[model samples]
Target: MKITFPHMGNAHIAIKALLAGLKLEVIPPPPITKRTMELGIKHSPEFACLPLKISVGSFIEALEQGADTVLMAGGWGPCRFGYYAQVERDILKDLGYSFRMVVLEAPDFKLSELLNQIKDLSQKVTTLEAVQATRFAWFKLNAVDRLEFCLAKMLPRVINKEEVLAIYRQALQEIDQVTTRPQVNQVTNKSTAEMEQLQQHDQPLLRLGLVGEIYTILEPACNYDIAEQLGRMNVEVYRSVYISDWVNDHLLGGLVKPSNRREILTSSRPYLNYFVGGHGRETVGNAVKLARQHYDGIIQIGPLTCMPEIVAQSVLGEVGEKEGIPVMTMYFDEHAGATGIQTRLEAFVDMLQRRKKSNQVWEQGEQLNAHVPGC
Candidate 1:
């Protein structure tokens, strides 16, 4: 059986390498595009997470490429992500597609359970082999995400916009071929060292932490590649969610949202127990951490109907107000506009710069309706 995972961002490299190293056959669907979103919107539930729809479209595309098995992460919570795999699978089956889906569910705390899910998710793969695959998958995911973080931190210094993407592409390609930890570290270190050499300056550019739902924040096709766009505009950005984050969230009870109490209390041993649900609370904590480190601003991105992010939206607003930081909130969907997003981003970045100079910040609890329909 051939396995395929949905595309999220510039993460295909490390993830692909993990599969390759494990000798598991896997494929990634094409990047989200106008046609991909169109198909997703046409077939999926109107209120579904934009990522889920894009993922469905991605799976269908992969199936066309001779992939018969799909792998997806599973969850359980107030968030809709918990039910995404089952729903998407049913949708695919109803569309007359013949394929097997492997969903790794949360609420199973044991490492053994996770390994079991890995086995189950990789249809036709043996349990022992699946355990090995999980380790490889983790290595690939951590490597890719850390590389992204390093690149993001360096983007503000990249004078040429095209060069940044070129370097990014190069790193992605190199990572896809990596096997051992030393190889992964060497690849990342070299890529980041080059980026730093190219992006050196006396003063850093505006640093913004991006927090929100998993898809709209990570998938460029869905959010119009906002992070790349932000990087081009000379804003250093950090993303909130990742494949590993989801894995940890499900495995560790939940992604703590500090806005909630029980989660924080239950998380005594863990330093980040305050993060209650999703990246909303964690986003705030990260922003506070970044702000204390002297970052310029925080950007809170979310889907319109997503309750966790909605909770994040409000709490982050309060956080921004109290901390005297400039925060930009944008809600995205199928109807989101590129031009508008860029324009608001420009304005926000400009505002952040001005606020830094004047020692002033956005009014407490101010709301910007960067909202679009169908989110």
Candidate 2:
């Protein structure tokens, strides 16, 4: 079977490796572009979230390239994401596309069924081979995440931001091409060293935390590359979502320790005590935690009409007021424009910088007062 899946940032790399390892012909969808966005908007319902539309377009592009199966992840929550796979399947069927829709739902205590489905997908492969493939794919996922973490740290500090991006892109390509863990490690280390070697300004940098819907948080195309944009503006960003962290919570909950979820809940207890579905609680929690840690500001980005993020955005006002941290929420859809988003981001960054300068001046004035004797 020729299997394909929607693009979600670096997820395509590990997913492609996993399917190829399972002895299936993998047909990765083309990189998301304006055409992809147009296709999704044209076919999807008017009210559907941006992710669903983009995913439909991605699947169509892959299917047109001879892929026979579409692999999609399923969710269970009040969030509309849980229904996306079924919705997309219907849309594709109506368009007269012939393909198998494979939905990998959250295990939800039915792990045996999940394994059985995976086994069925690769009947020719043995259990040991599947285990090895899965292990390798996990390593690849972590490797890229490490690279991203490094890139986030270096992007704001490096003198030549474009050079840092080029190194990061090259490193990702090398990681994708390698098959072994050692090779992945070697490339990650080399690229990280190269980034570190680049000349950097010694000025203090603004730290911003990004919290929002998983797809928009992880997919640059959906969020107008907010992380990169902030980085180029000399802001150090701490993102709330990572694919490995999501897998740890949903797919491998039994096997992996849910430390991340526990931390999120603990921090979110004051503002939101329960899951509002999607990453709503996590967004609130991460924002609070980042505020306590003295992050300069926080930005929440998600698709328009996303109920969970909307809930979190409402709560964030109180969080910002109580914690003394500035908060901004950005919602996007098919009609969202890059220029407008960038202008907003630029304004936010400038405000943070001005606030920092004002704070410094106040501190200096306070020090001067301390030196005077009862003026």
Candidate 3:
């Protein structure tokens, strides 16, 4: 079967590696772009979340490129994500596209079913081969996450930001071409070292935490590359979610230990105690975590009309007030513009800088007064 899947940040890279290793003819969807968004918007429900539209557009693109089957992840929660695969299937069918849809349901509670699905997809491969292929893809996933983490840490500090990004793109390309553990490790290490060599300023900058729906948080096209924009503005950006962490905690049954969900749920208790759907709880939890860690601010991005993120956004205001942390919520759709987002980001950064300086001065004054007299 000629297989294809939706793009989510570096996910396509690992997915390409996995399907190819299974000896399948993999048709990688074209990168999300204006045209893709247009195609999705024209055909999707007016009120559907942004991710659904983009993914539908992506699937259509892949199908046009001769992909006979579409592989998408399924969810089982209050979030609308759980319904994506079936909805996209019907939408594509109505559009008169002839293709098969495969939904890989959340495997945490259905390992055997998930394994069977995998085996069926890898038709001619042995069990051992399938296991090896999965392991290789897992390593690639971890490598991509590590490379991204390094880029986030180095982006704001680099003297020439473009140079760091150039190396990063090249490193991603190199990593994408590899199929073995050692090769993934070699490229990741080389990329990290190259990033480390970029000239950096020693002074600290405003630190911002990003928390939101997973797709919007990770996909640049979806969020207009907000993290890079923040980095360019001399702000340090930290995301609450990563592909590897999500896969490990949810799909792998917490094999890595110290469950991300546990930590998030515990921290979110003061604001939201139960799962409201999507990453709403996690967003609140992460915001609380970042607040306690003394981050300058937090930005929450999600698709317009997304229930979970909306719930999180409502609670975040109270959290921000209580914790004395600034919070900004951004909703994206086809109508969202980069220029507008940049303007807001600039204003937020300016506010944080002013607050930081004010606090510093106030502390200094208090110290001086204490040393001068008992009063």
- List the candidates ranked by TM-score, beginning with the highest: 3, 2, 1
User: lDDT tens string, model 1, 192-213?
Assistant: 7877777455564777878667
lDDT of 2 by residue, 253-343 (tens): 5455345778877998789998899999989999999999999999999999999999999999999999999999999998888899999
Q: Which regions in candidate 3 have their CA more than 4 angstroms from the true location?
A: 110-112, 256-258, 373-375
Which run of 10 residues does model 3 get worst, by summed lDDT?
249-258
How would you order the candidates by lDDT, starting with the best? 2, 3, 1
Models 1 onward score TM values of 0.82, 0.96, 0.97
In lDDT terms, how accurate is model 2?
0.90
Q: Give lDDT: candidate 1, residue 95.
A: 91
Clashing pairs in 2: none
TM-score of 2: 0.96
Q: Is candidate 1 or candidate 3 better by TM-score?
A: 3
Candidate 1's displacement at residue 35, Å, is 2.4
